[model samples]
Target: MKKNALLDAAEALLSEQGTQALTLTAVADRAGVSKGGLLYHFPTKEALVKGLVARVIEEFDALVAEHEDGAPGSYSRAYVEATFEILTGEARAHRRWSAIMAAATDPELAAPLNEAMTRWHGRAPDEDPDPVTGVIVRLAAEGLWEVLSHTPELYGTARLDALKQRLLALTRG
Candidate 1:
């Protein structure tokens, strides 16, 4: 739909040009829609940003769900699987990084993302009986995500796979 197009345009602008270039006018132009059309979907830049954040969170949740099984530590395992996928997938990497940067710059914009993460992390303790191990695995996965976001070349594919496999193994225990 047109709303998705506008969101895609906004994400493209954010990823390609950075935050300063992500105005409503720029997004409207990029989507090949008129200003009124853009306004019909998203009235303000903040609303657009929230839409982007929500989309990313929804996509990530679906990815995690795909990895989930009816077992202990499933959420932790899914988190690791989903995080690794995002880190390695090119388009996903760009979209995720753009959303993260936008959220980092504005506290109000960060609320949705922060809340989603809090909900996920809260489930970790309940999903994995061994709370400490779950926390450790989650932290390790998150730490790698943060590091790679800055310096993607920090680890080669083989090493990254090894790390991912190790984390997944921990989830079984």
Candidate 2:
């Protein structure tokens, strides 16, 4: 519970105040926990980063799984569904992805981020026979997300929604 609180605080800081505010002290203060308390769960900033990355992976897996049930023989749709879920999910969901992906710039973080994405490439735990379209869906979604996060003026809401709907249809095959 304490650990999760720290992670949530970190995400909030990252989203609200930018990466510079994601210090241990800031996170501790945000969580209403002692600095020592934060350190007990995450010994260092790197450890805290790892926790955040883990949260990202965990959340992504659940998003994918949530869309898996009704997709019949293909998980391709699930990939798009998961993307849409993230894009349209609560602000924290979108912010979490942006924060983790941005944090992945550190050399130490690259492996874990890549590993999580690679695992995603392997498809959900249940094993979806068709995995190719998933990669495409992820690519398109990430591209759209990159724009939406950094340059909202590039795409209007209707256009974004229309594009997502079209992408979903394409991935259906």
TM-score of candidate 2 versus the correct structure, residues matched by position: 0.76
Candidate 2 on 48-151: residue-level lDDT in tens? 88888877777777877787765543466676677667666664244555456546669776577788777666655334334565567767877776666655
Clashing pairs in 1: none
| True-structure Cα RMSD, model 2 | 3.7
Each prediction's Cα lDDT score?
0.85, 0.71
As for candidate 2, its clashing pairs are none
| Candidate 1 local Cα displacement, residue 128, angstroms | 2.2
Candidate 1 error regions (>4 Å): 124-126
Residue 139, candidate 1: alpha-carbon lDDT: 90
Each prediction's number of clashing residue pairs: 0, 0
**Could you tell me every candidate's TM-score relative to the true structure?**
0.85, 0.76
